[model samples]
Target: MRTEETPLGRKRRARKINRVLAETYPYAVAELDFRNPFELLVATVLSAQTTDVRVNAITPALFAAYPDPLAMSQAAPEALQELIRSTGFFRAKANSLLALSTRIVDEYDGVVPGRLEDLVTLAGVGRKTANVVLGNAFGVPGITVDTHFIRLARRFGWTNETDPVKIEHAVGELFEPSDWTMLSHRVVFHGRRICLARKPACGACPLTTLCPAYGEGETDAAKAAKLLKYELAPGREELLKKMRAGATRAELRTEGYGLQA
Candidate 1:
């Protein structure tokens, strides 16, 4: 069995993993496209139990039709349901969107509330959604403990707790507040690209040396490379070539890639 690290050792390892993630995904961010907090909030809600790409596919038309809370609040329920039908749970999601939009208009005067307390008070909003809005929209740093983040956290030996709030607090103690939001993005990116849910590309992972669950997935370079996604995949071979040429571990570490030791 793998031995657990001391508290300080765990903290050091967590920061190191985060640092490598920072280099691997220098510009990592939400895949869901949106122009404003309201759009992000709506898109994120639609994103539940669905892919971000799917959410992005539908949002342009959705946003064009209901550009703001007041407009969204007044949207015809059937029309709204049809528009978001592809995202799944159309009726319930539609109800949430309309109810939340109505709340935003009636209570917050059409502006999506900036405060976490206020944001969560809106219908269908939760801590995760609130964190996404706060971090991306308001520039407030927050740890979004999504499935990806949660999985990576445990794999990297950061936290054992499955409860999102507990996971958030546990991992939160490892980094500076300013790092929380980007940290979430990087971790999520790594989870999707390398440390995947079913079969992780462990052999191609830059952090395999630091990851506690290193051998849990495909550990052959040829096979592992086949498992990469998006820009890290065969379609982006040229970009991967360029990234490999320049992004060395030493170079990445020099760019504040890992935690201070």
Candidate 2:
């Protein structure tokens, strides 16, 4: 059977997906913990192959020691590496942090540059990191196509490109500039929670009805059940538990249950 393409069909599906995602993840935000542009740059650098939680844990000590670009620039490479050791890629990250800090101190007058091009010129700062700092720290609109965002974009038929830059362009075309930062966070959240890489929980995913990949791997009830069973593994269980607790507390407060009990 040939698939029918209609404007109404596409619009309805898109709207439904957006509405469900917005409602389900009303408070979706960047998980990276940073207070300023410099901190964000450092955190993003440290978070290359590491988890944000690990990066966050390391940043407190690192930031406390250095605090700013000048201080970090002057910091010993060994000292910086020791501070960021837990975040993995310590040697490379330390070098990047030191080099980037020196550039900020000498070139940018100790301020993180707001412009995307200028930000990317810093050592170890790619488009994704630059975008994160620009959008979140400097109030600039830029699309961040990290692994999660990239994976989801491809899965959702937002783009077929594997290159991060291409994916960013494709997404920018789909959504407004104002929604760039928040949209990245939302896609990342959805990718991590429901629309996972290996076995997506399409049945429970808020965007499944809108996703073209939905039910692609499910040919039988038993296979679907097996996939769902794998989704409940210990690591997934822990993540879901934490997310559920946070959501439950927010819901309770919104419903005035917090005041009652």
lDDT of 1: 0.86
Model 2 poorest 10 in a row by lDDT:
252-261
- Which one wins on lDDT? 1
lDDT per residue as tens, model 2, 185-244 = 777777766666777767665565578888754435444434543224323554444444
- TM-score, cand. 2 vs. native: 0.81
Clashing residue pairs in candidate 2 are: none
> lDDT by residue for model 1 over 1-261, one digit each (tens)?
258578888878788888888888875777677789999999999999988877877888999999999999999999999999999999999999999999998888899999999988887889999999999999999999899999999988888899999999999999989999999999998888889999999989999789889999999999999998866875665555544565543344355433111
Every candidate's lDDT: 0.86, 0.75
- Residue 234 lDDT in model 2? 27
TM-scores, all candidates, are: 0.90, 0.81
